[model samples]
Target chain A: MSAENAAGTPPLLDVKNLSVRYPLRSGVVEAVRGVSFVLGRERLGIVGESGSGKSQTGRAILGLTPQPGIVAADRLRFDGIDLLSLPPREMRRLRGRRISMVMQDPKYSLNPVMTVGAQIVEACRVQKLAGGRAAKDRALDMLAAVKIDDPRRVFGLYPHELSGGMGQRAMIAMMLVGEPDLLIADEPTSALDVTIQLEVLKILDELVATRGMGLVFISHDLRLVASFCDRVLVMYGGRIVEEVAAARLGEAGHPYTRGLLGSAPRLSGSVHPLPVLERDPAWLA
Target chain B: MAVPTPPAAQHDRGLPAPPAGLKAWLTSPAPASRTQARLGRFYRGWRGFVRNPAAMAGFVIVLLLLVVAASADLIATHSPTVAGDLRTERLLPPGGEFWLGTDDQARDIWSRIVHGSRVTLVVVLLVSVISMPVGLAVGTVSGYAGGVVDAVLMRITDIFLAFPRLVLALAFVAALGPGIENAIIAIAITAWPPYARLARAEALQLRGADFIAAAKLQGASPLRIVAVHIVPMCMPSVIVRVTLDMAGVILIAAGLGFLGLGAQPPQPEWGAMVASGRRFLIDQWWVAAMPGAAIFIVSLGFNLLGDGLRDVLDPKAAER
Candidate 1:
């Protein structure tokens, strides 16, 4: 990472020993434990199964963990600002304009009634950027950037009118419209078909490279992560068990990582049953 | 139903397309597909509603009632309250200029019913204006915040709701003393809980949605999130509640008048007119029937409008 990009100090977002716990009516359950990472102006992928708290870690860093979910960290900094200490009012300013998120399913992520353009316009207008006409111009430009053929028409169409791929593209457009420095894409392409998945990933790649943006791509598919991301953080049982460059995934040292890799079926594999994961209690801690 | 059309399918259509320049793109609109070409999309939602048998009947009834109320001057020749000792026209049946006949006091029953509708509409609208905002505010905060705020506000609503609405309104009027304004206030206080409950449930569902979280991430203030995202989405349900509540308010206002807590005797109110007409019902049936029919028709109209609205405005329903 360039020193100038990192502001002559730590990474753009640095989370050291972050933990999240939920205090339900009955008892407290730890969701994330001792999860730590440093995000630079490049793609960092966190791969984990659903309950492993990869999503919680993302929310905690953004100071957006839903209420009753306790988040504590030794240090959580975004662009050198202490994230854990910012008031809600200040955190809000940092949220969409500086660090935006692309949620999993565009079906639920986008508001059903709002048109794609209006939702994007809302993201821009919330930052009080260019008023009516300029905002509309920027929204159309962003929609075009996402490869939407007819921005003018798509601008007036509601979420249900768009296909899953188009919705995700619109969501990406909305998130990027504010020109955020850091983008968190939580399984952005999982809901789409394989062809659309490639299209979406390509779009994200273009945005990240062209804008010099830092990306935290959260997903469960290790293959996708390894293929697209620069660095991969393999998480299990609410903790990041291993971190490796994408090129060194085959040479990964952790037993759990190896187990996950072995279990996934290869395209050229012979007619044999897929390998199953073997649990190790010590690996969880 | 077949291979689903991707959003890009229209790009390759062989028809002469607009040039991909600013003016051409701006001036030439996309060709409308079959669904878009249908004129159903352009009609006001109310026109769609009036096509339904029940809603159409309701619309006609409500419209007729409003017209009769507003144009009372043209419709009725005599004053409703004045009891000129018309010893001759007293208790007369439907005949001559007095179509609904005359009361024991020699007052015109048709004229009274016509004028009485104006009062009912006024009270219902006034009470609704007073209480809808209060209910919306309380319900939204309670539902969105949850926990202590929710529990405390809900308990208060429950306390109010526990009492029979009519009796509570009666008690409030008695405490505040008998008058139209006091009656409106009394009716408003009794009516807000249902709206609060409906709004709270709607807000609870809305609060969990991802766009709300998205709005938060977009730096939208709490008020903006509520106003722009949450409230507008909640409006269809809120509208249904308001329409439903209008009937209840009218009923309560009439009940208050029945107890002599509404418009004074000289002024025409359906309930007060009915109360006065009751003493002479055996001989003066027309006196009770006209105003009674007015109350029933107007209330039924609002109820039908509300139910029809609930079906038409729903986004899921609209898709079908």
Candidate 2:
């Protein structure tokens, strides 16, 4: 809590007028349109529906937009460096070492052919952190840090061999092994069961608290985001419709936010039918 | 080495009359070291390979090929190349002093076939060694590096694929001049396009996979991603394909030899032997029939092995 950040110093990541567009034969489909936000060393959640560009925003931050998807941001800066102008080689050097992203599905994110330990060691060694035995030891330490009971046994395991929770933890370990300053987790716990979800979240929570790492937690679960994130950005039709403190999420003035809240089936309220969200034409504007 | 005690494992929950020593070691639920893990994986693949009867037959046949190629000189009763008492031995049928009869030159058929196994082995080995690497490299790079690189490499692959393999190989032999080495080179050149195609297809599938994306996000260079990750996933299929292709390679080598462009006279190349035997095909069937049967059996063996390997190594098959 006492770690210093002088007043005139920039935030960990600064994004202004960020847009991701995919050119189809028919027309240009703007996935994220003029979306802008800044992230400090805090847990910031982006909540949206399936096509709501939360994942794209996270990917765009790390410059992981797929080929042919044009990413344009007026000022996309990370740790005082201009991410927009950074060459691929320099971007690659910055990735995993200074900035890392944990993809949603651990099943797919972890390489099936490689052992968990080998993947972790690769992420570590490629950053020029440690070599040979030391890198291996560091990887093992990371697995244990994620609260995996038997790091040694799991290290030799292929991704398919591990259950969902274990694989998710191993994914986290691989991401955190390089010790990046900013971590972008894209719906990390969606594929996991309820109990496993909490465990994964706890691990992420601890890392953010102890290591002072900035986290962009992208998920659609309003309640989960409200409980976990310090602040929330509600995205609609590729734009930020509402931004509110996590505690005041219920009091958000946006009709879309109210519709999203109204749609959820609450155990306490004995409502016969859940309210469906009304499609708004003006949110795109 | 002293036998170390087993580490307490989570998998040891339902232990009822546990296994001991060798069986226990082989059946060990969790391997302690990297060597153990690799050996265990290989051992499992081997187990899968041997389970099917046809694959086993093919494996045995390939083994026979190796043994025969290795000790060709020791097994033969007479000299393969040197003519002996042409008056008595010429055009003799099977079950005489000569087995499988003699060629027009009065050389022993059995001896020639035995010695010819050596040539067959060399051609197969040389072709595979040269072709698989080339195909794998081109395919993986092209697939992983998409866009211009992908387009350019694929077009080049398409050009190679457009040619009929044997005709292209024949053309290569014509250009390079005839010899066993040149024939093998030609065969190798024709052989790699298919592998490159196969590898590229696999690379295309893998390049977009979540694991690859994860690696990309984590700063893995394109070369590292292609070689380390994409190539290995493509390996199981490549290996299966290569085994299958070996049969084709053997046949191609024999075809070149039959055309008199492969091994020179007196070397006992199977295809050349078949060519010579074809002269006396009507009356003296054993001369041609023997070499023809040898080629058929060897090719069949390689094919059976390849089929069995597919059952074991094919990822899709593994799921079933």
Candidate 3:
């Protein structure tokens, strides 16, 4: 934080007191409450359980919260543009060009009928970044960067034809082809095999490093986040309860985070019984 | 049952393996050519169609009718509308010059049945052409947009569906006056609601799909999303519905013709042919029976084709 501030460079994405609420017949469910974080040209991990509002926070930043959900914030800015007050057309322009999202599962995220290359080309085309042959070349290049050995063969394949690993790579290729400034990845590798997961992470790491883009890596795997991210935010009961450097995650003082860490299975140590997470009502408030 | 020998066992004798890259290329599951892939798809579709005997029979019947409709001039022995000699040729039985015999008006019944196919073909084609686009547009817009738009469009569709298809077509034809074009319009109007409902249901299911959301996040316009993403996905089901509905459309068109609101006098129409021959039904059974048989066969063809399409197009059915 000191090094970033000393350089006098504004964060790429800045958020203060962000909250997301969904209205239901019963009452309002506060999916994310007063969560705040700042992202620079580095990886920021948000780790939490399924209902801890980590994914909601990522979606709120992109203005992609589904219907019946309302997003309110004291301030939300992206590269000096006021995202909260920006017009929808302006917001749309900002999306995919400046900020892009890679959703959880490529199986459902990629268009089933469209060829992989066509979908990647479309992402570039929509932003007016490239078109026709140029878009095709850029898409092929991005596929190669993702380590797809034969981009030519994969270019003509439907999503269903590709394996789980190939589909995720295509999805990543589509997202990164636009050369967006900020990327939000929501549990991008949770659906893949262990080896494939490592390969995907390596690709993400290389792309982020070379491009110098900000990344919001949302996941529930505490160990993966600690190893991969520069900073970590632990969310619980719709709010971030702990924010620490990834290296210092072991020293986190929050009880919920401690409970989560304790529950994780260890390789060497043998314990008679595994610990379970216990919730407290005070965390909600 | 005898067990087949394993490839590994068969290759027990010392033999040199093929070059690595060549073996990989040969063993690769990719199709050799685009034509090969298309042929594979066609073969699978054919296999599925043949499995259902009723559908195969229906397909054959439809194919025969299509041939009859396309080559009406070459097949018919005489001009469909030309009247025979009233003094001698009137109400002749099935034998002599007339194959299916002459009607009460002395026109060749077989020629009338053959030429009537052209009218039926036109009605089915025109009705479907008009109805499908309108229905797809309405349904896609209603379902994708949801909320107020969905409510309004779907309610309108429900109102249309409330009436019996024939009764609605009859009413529309009654208002538009008697003619082939009017009959087409009437039937098209009555035919679109089912397609709209089907398309709407499909769109609703797809509206929240991850691909659609991804497209939206890519800043795709609403029109682009509906057209590129939503429409293509909805097409298989819509196509199945269209095939099934063609039979209904044909039946309704014939019904309109029977009520004197389609094809007019002197023109051969199956339903009108049946209606005119009813007076002489006991005396000359072939006149009504021939056209009735034609109607029954064509409708059966459409039904079978629709069923076959459903089995092939649906992935779940394909797995079974």
Q: What's the best-to-worst order under DockQ?
A: 2, 3, 1
DockQ measured for candidate 3: 0.71
Clashing residue pairs in candidate 2 are none
Q: List, residue by residue over A1-285, the lDDT tens digit for candidate 1.
A: 322353366678888899999999899988999998888888999998889899888888778889889999999999889988898889888988999999988998888878888998888889887779999999999999999999999999999989999999999998899999999988899999999999999999999999999999999999999999999999998999999999889999998899989888867847366577887999875
Q: What is the C-alpha lDDT profile of model 2 across A106-220, one tens digit per residue?
A: 8999998899999999988778789899999999999999999999999999999999999999998999888899999999999999998998899989987899899999999
When sorted by TM-score, best at the front, the candidate numbers are 3, 2, 1
Q: How high is the TM-score of chain A in model 3? A: 0.97
Would you give the TM-score of chain B in model 2?
Answer: 0.86
TM-score, first chain, each model: 0.96, 0.97, 0.97
Which segments of model 1 are wrong by more than 4 Å?
A: A1-7, A25-27, B1-55, B80-91, B175-177, B304-320
State every prediction's TM-score relative to the real structure: 0.88, 0.90, 0.90
Which window of ten consecutive residues has the lowest lDDT sum in model 1 chain B?
A: B31-40
DockQ of each: 0.64, 0.73, 0.71
Model 2's TM-score against the true structure = 0.90
Which portions of model 2 show Cα errors greater than 4 Å? Answer: A1-6, B1-15, B18-56, B85-88, B312-320
Best by DockQ: 2
CA error at residue B80 for candidate 2, angstroms: 3.2
CA RMSD of each candidate after superposition: 6.3, 4.4, 5.1
